[model samples]
Target: MAANAPFTPPLALASLSGEADADWARAGAAYAGAAFLGGIALDADSRAAARELVARDRSEFLPDEPITFIDRELAALGDVPIQPAFNVRSATVEPVAEAARVCRDRDTLLEINAHCRQDELCAVGCGETLLRDRERLATYVERAAETGVTVGAKVRAEVPGVDLPVLARDLEAAGAAFVHVDAMDSEPVIADVADATDLFVIANNGVRDTETVREYVEYGADAVSVGRPSDNPTVLERVRAAVDREFGLEATR
Candidate 1:
């Protein structure tokens, strides 16, 4: 079992369209224990894919030197109490390794992105495509682990023929410190993955009101991340209050 991240209430602000930078993290800092700051495209193939998404008017971070950009973004947090985590997309393992170095230097968590279902990203082997290739995804996790940063993956649920529980175990074996699951419509699957491995599980999707937050908590999620409504104080406050009420101080690590 991996040691839990220092996510106070164990709640996070999920990356939004690659725009969950420092400002976004700060905006939700009051309620969240951590914030995933990107679904950044880190290598040439992923960068090209990100550009394609941008062409379609989707938001993406396409910096010239991605490592520098990553360092800058993490640096911008400037001692916020919340854990700073970067969610990245890469077709190859090298970029993930490089980002791990930056994350290590900044004391940030590094998340590999296997949750993006974007056709453009998947076409380049950068996102949901990894969900289908367990070995490759594990290899990426293994390489990132070599860098000694707190590394993990943001995975999507309900991918056909993919057993997320098995995959979660594989990632745990590969030295993953945590697994952030986007439990699409199969919310109960959160329990399956959590049961499959001791890795810290962060449940995502439809995390709005107290009911939704309570559901994930009951399902064995060590934490929950708010998606589209991350910036909505009404929703985050409700979710935060629910988290505190459910998990309480004992939940803090």
Candidate 2:
């Protein structure tokens, strides 16, 4: 499998799911960096799993309408040339492969969602539950890689007993192009994972400014990602400026 293209600005808009609609995608594309088009559950089974969790907790925002195909859900982004990636969740390889194919056809990146911690998603053996089954997670990555699209896996770093670097290595062995890590509060894990695998590392979590962005890059992240703060143009610009200044790269925005 071919390695995915590197993220342009060394900065990305982390996946935010339901809130990452067409407008959000447009907003992200307007910036001078990579944009991860939120997490989209691959099929009915995956959507149901998310819905069950959302029903129990009204705060969780899942798609109110059903999204049957990954491409169909992402179609609203249209033909924008920005570096766009799609985050997906599934309990089995079939859906992952299917979504990966869509990404391949659309010329985008497909990221496996192994970072979500929803109770219902975990109960159904999806999301962060996949972290517990490294072998299965590898299988999922392998299946997605077969599509010839860039395959990335987004994983949480704080899961108890789960070695983040080891998991990253497993993904590399399975042919993933990059590992998107929600490092939580552990900046060291970013360096560790980068050291453990050859795959590109995109660091997520607690990045509110240039200092944090520079900190992650210093920790060995090929790219640093921002989520909630990306909704604000001013914050996004500040963070983007930091990346530009520290990395000596120009912003596309």
Candidate 3:
């Protein structure tokens, strides 16, 4: 939500929790220059709930320890503040509030994972399921905001029947600090979302280099994020240089 800063760094390292923990320490060091970094998305509820999600989708994985352990893993990133995204399967706001409190205590941001498409998560009315239930999602955001930590909602742009721009507006109205959109091949959606809300708009998906970074900026995104490509330092450097040259933005490193 630091959009007021002149020349905000256009590139950020997106969430890579499940697949990258083994290399997380090294990977975090490699992309330390990123303007923003997101920790792996985790289930913010009980282990039994996490296991149920995993059982439904073999690809879904959550840490075995308490959610606070995520704080320790993220601390390994050192100076690069991490916004830890969490997927909660609860019908109430207590879990969301607890996650937000953790982030607040850690002096970092908390992002609600409404962008994930895992089957098990969807079945439990979590993840993309929130997309269809905008009111409920807004309540969750509102609850998270009560913790006094910056709360962001991550959403996919391509979900059927859900208007991305309107959703962004609703989230902002609900006290969300920003809306992270997985633009997913549609740069204009970023434009629409940016136009609809005053909240910081973070563009995600298919970002590979400077051109893509500039493209999203031109489309009105406050910032752009890189996922898999951030695993390689050389690639991250190229994108960072591009952002600096194209937007006159300096890396915060």
Local distance difference test, each candidate: 0.90, 0.79, 0.66
Order of models, best lDDT first: 1, 2, 3
Q: Mind giving the per-residue lDDT tens digits that candidate 1 earns over 1-253?
A: 2356546678999998767999899889989999999889999899999998999999988889989988998888977878999999999998899999999999999999999998999999988999999999999999989999988999998899999999999999999989999999999999999888999999999998779888998999999999999989999988888888777753553
Q: Model 1, which residues run further than 4 Å from truth?
A: 1-3, 250-253
For model 3, the run of ten residues with the poorest summed lDDT: 32-41
Query: Which run of 10 residues does model 2 get worst, by summed lDDT?
Result: 58-67
Measured on C-alpha atoms, candidate 3 has an lDDT of 0.66
Candidate 3, residue 117: lDDT: 76
Clash-forming residue pairs, model 2: none
Q: List the residue pairs that clash in candidate 3.
A: 17-40
Higher-scoring candidate on TM-score, 1 or 2: 1
